[model samples]
Target: MRHLISIAAFIATCAVLVWVFLPDPVPVETAPITRGDVTVRVEAEGEARVREVVVISAPITGLLQRVTLHPGDAVTAGQVLAQIGPVTPALLDSRARAVAESTAAAAAAAVELARSQLVQAEASLTFARAEADRTRALFERAALSQRMLDDAVLAERTAEATLASARANLAVREKELDSAKAMLNGDYAEDTACCIHVTSPVTGRILGVRTEDEQVLQAGTPIMEVGDLQDLEIMVSVLSREAVNIAEGAEATITGWGGPDLAARVERVEPGATTKISALGIEEQRVEVRLSLLAPAPPALGHGFRVTARITIDMAQNILRVPVSALFRSKGDWAVYSVEDGKAALQIVSLGRRNDEFAEVLDGLTEGATVIVHPADTVENGSAVEEKPLIGG
Candidate 1:
């Protein structure tokens, strides 16, 4: 009876020990959940560009006799850039002499002719008045016949007509003399040999110098380019489907092309979509978006510099944030497992802003709550769990 009793006791003790020490239903490894401020952002890639680019060209075709400036030279408005050609000494002298002689002779002739015409017109007018006065006096005194008075009046009229014609001729001569003077004063002289100096249209650094010494340039050919480096913008191409959600004034973070990350804002979303052929020859619709750098542009930022950009179309701050993998659909509603006391308690959650990595927890979860990421499909609610480090932690 004693041995049997001792055996029963030992069996009972072993059962108790097994119940106490047997591995607590091997707890599945889980990551410790921690939360802080989370930021949601959209990522994109693009290139830096100047806000304004001006292409300079010669207004007339001529030999580029001199290029006083070269590429990268700083210039101001109206500053002379280059001189084409100078007037030849012989031609200049010839033009000067011809203009001088012609002008002097023409001026003398004009003055003499105008004086003569004025004197004649004055004499005619005086004679006509005197004859009319004499005719009136004769009629009053009854000493002259009416036919004689009339004949005298006709004579006066003829003299007046002649004076008028002379005055008109004098005016024409005066105009001709003025024109002759202008031509003789080198106004009509062709300065074909003189260099046509090109001037800067705007204050900027010359980006290019197309012509060297004595190169002939055609009209409207671009000779140089000028741009304001201070004012810079970024142009990015986005997938057509993604572009629809982007709007003007959206915030963007630009990075990776040589400079530090920069903050930019969308200036415009181009309306037109273009078809792009991929390496696989698949047609893809894309749109170009222009972004103006809000921050001061770095000196290293240059035109066509490729960059990676993250455009923030949506954002939220100071919210309960959880890893996106922790979110799962439960009966058409979003749910997550809140790990507490080494167990996952399935809890439905209301969510707010979401980004590529995290989802904002609006309700049913608090900051610092441990949540299971990528919970197993077989894992049941209120199941035991063991904490494990995340891969990238």
Candidate 2:
């Protein structure tokens, strides 16, 4: 009887120890539903750009002379940027002189063509001037209306400009003819002849110089890019599907520009989509969104500065919300493991607009209600739970 009592007491002590050593509280973390404001936004990477980019091109074909301007150099309107002059005439040999004679003949024919055009332009101008004089006299006598008189005056001015342009063309053709003759005589002095100065069209800093060295270029060849640094905009490429939600005048918060956050607004959403290779080597359909800064941007930030954009598409105030991890699909319906009396109770909940961090709870979950975030498979309805310290507390 003494052995039986001792054994029973020892078994009771072992049972107590087993109860004390049970796994600590399932090792699960918990969060509570709360009332707060939530902003629905699409985050994207973007780059800073100029509001207006201008390209200064070579207006006339010639050999480009010394270009003193460099990138980032301040320039003003009408300031000379570069010089273009005639190409060098090659030294004449017996074969070269024969080629030069052919060129001279072609230049002479061009001069004749230019002279005929000048004569036609002069005749038109003379007629226009005579008609204008007659119209002015009639207007003075109240025979012609002011509109007719103005028309005649405009016609005369246009004709005069045409004639002057024709005369200039004739002079250029004559010079070409003379130069051709000089080339036939083995004169290579055209290389160092007078040059045409290329002037800046706008007051801004040079962004890029396409031709840094002297070289022969054709007319309309691009030379440099100039833009005002103070005038800036942003270019954000977002997924085409997400771009549909964005509209003009939507608010945007720009960050990661190596400065403080800046306020901006969407100016335009491009109508077209383009294919782009993502960082992960996946192809994505993307659309460009243009935004204008609401406040002045940082002075140090220049064109092509990398940035991150958070565009707010929707919002809600004083909405009941919970961490999105607490929600799970149950029978094709949204459900959550609600903790009540320290037990996991399955509760069906309605949801509304959601963001990356939180989901808006419409029903079944209330403020101060504890919900199991990422509940384990064993955490089911009517199961006892020991809540660990709150996540991210």
Candidate 3:
């Protein structure tokens, strides 16, 4: 009985010793190194703008009539948007009235002279015709020479041409008289005002009105702006140094534009750089990167809408990758705690590229190898680890 009791005690002691000496598994989350594809992107905040923007302007120097259309009003081509009349003249006094009357009288006299000249030309033409008829009859009867008949015919044609010229002169004189009368009454008065209707040149919505009321404006003054909402492009301004990495035809992803993520492509990188004040109040050398939408942009995406853009600068396919969280500095080299046989194994990895979530593993890791993400400070090489599935896999 003593021997059996001693054996039982030794066994219990051995069990306690084994339980105390054995290491406990460290709690950790891990993900297997993946071999698939990864994309490297450069991100920026961008602004949406119409591909084409047009400013409507007054074509003539005149009073700018009140614009009834407000901002964001849809318009079509050739739609009359505003009407401008010639500037109304100041009040006319006695001396001004006298001068105007004298000018009107001169115009009337010019018209009378033209009418008299036309009447004279008509009389001369009639006389020439009679003479030509008589000369032709005499020539047929052998009573007059051929040269005389020819001369009479020529005179008749000349007189007819003169009469036509006089008629043209009379028309000009009448127009001049009307113009003088209009000026005397008032420039652009109710009866004789020359009103010009300004029409929309294209189909679009009104962006803004430069002149809102009955303000006098000079010729070519901007009155309004129009731009198609459907035709939209993304303008991303990036640092000039970073722009060198962006190339035309790179795939761009746009988000936060009041719709689904829009697929786009880099259409152009401006050759010139502009200076812009950043949020930090530092002057930044920036270049514009224009993005062309791959699909039709949403109508809600209007001009100056804010958006975020991610441009893919590089891509690696079928390359081994690991979560960026798994990477840590060890012994002056990039390293990770790779799980092997349920123990954290220190690994020195050669990296190629990295993005937000993953880093390209050029060497020192293989597919299906699990790596501890955000390894704790207490964890070290050969530490027993308990693996938890990474969130979202």
Candidate 4:
């Protein structure tokens, strides 16, 4: 009995020692929960591009004899922006003299031909009338042979045909004379006008100039460019995955371009995607999206300027919101660890209208309630934790 008592005492002593020397659980640092409005935004970086750019090119090939206007020169439609090589005085004088001589010669020849044809037609007509009278007189008196009267009638018909032919010839000569006169007038030589008068097609400033004085340009070469700065737009390219969610008339906010945030609306989403090689050498499908500013853009903004855009895909007013980092997948449901007296208490949450950084808290949490952000896996119901201040809090 004494030995049994000693064994029990020894076991009791061991149990007490084990309980007294056990290590305490380690404490975890947690971010403090704050209450404020949280907005979820989708951010994209892109360059600004003009909505409409007009490229002015030479209509025909010639020496760029003059480029009187420089870039930023305001011009008007039909204004002579530049002039090509001018025609030499000697050439012009020779062409004029040749035309005058040719025209005079054609006129003299035409007049002579017309007079001769008119005289022939008149003579033939007189002869035909006299012959017809004689034929009638013979036929009536019966003093002439019938064959002679028939022959006289045939002669009169022949004379009439001759007169008609002569009149037709005169008409042909008149048309020929007009053609000859036109040729002698040197209308074709007026093509030299192409050497001068390069006019502006639209009233705007010159954006580019490709040629200087006396430079020869090929056909269809662009000599200058013009664009209306008042008409401006923002063109942004987005990944195909992101583009699918974007649609026309979506609201967007533009910022980080050296001005106040500007409101913009999506005008169009391009249908096709272009393949672009990323820095990793992976091909990405990108689609262009066009946005129009609802308010006037600052004058300082120019083409190809880089800016940040936040597209509001979803939004809700007066809805409970929580930091996105607080969300965790628990048993196939989104959950957060609510802090109560510096202890984590597991709570299931229903979310709605989630943005990039914040999520709308639809249920399970109230406003001004403290929730643990970035909860650890070891965190559980009734877990002891200490709330620490968040960065930038």
How well does each candidate superpose onto the true structure, as a TM-score? 0.56, 0.72, 0.69, 0.59
For model 1, what is the alpha-carbon lDDT of residue 121? 79
Model 1, residue 375: what's the lDDT?
79
lDDT of 2 by residue, 130-236 (tens): 99999999999999899999999999999999999999999999999998887787565544566888888888789889987889989999888888888989999
Instruction: Please write out the lDDT profile of model 3 over residues 286-317, one tens digit for every residue.
Output: 99999999988787788889999999999988
Which number leads on lDDT?
3
Backbone clashes in model 4:
0
Superior by lDDT: candidate 1 or candidate 3: 3
What stretches of model 2 exceed 4 Å from their correct place? Answer: 1-22, 98-183, 191-193, 328-333, 374-384, 391-393
Q: Which pairs of residues collide in candidate 1?
A: 30-388, 42-311, 44-309, 85-194, 85-195
Model 1 lDDT tens row, 45-114: 6777777778777777766666667866788988887665543223337767777777768777876887
Residue 318's lDDT in candidate 3: 88
Model 4 residue 383 CA deviation in Å: 4.5
Model 3 score (lDDT) = 0.92
Cα RMSD, model 4: 8.0
The candidate scoring highest on TM-score is 2
Q: Which pairs of residues collide in candidate 3? A: none
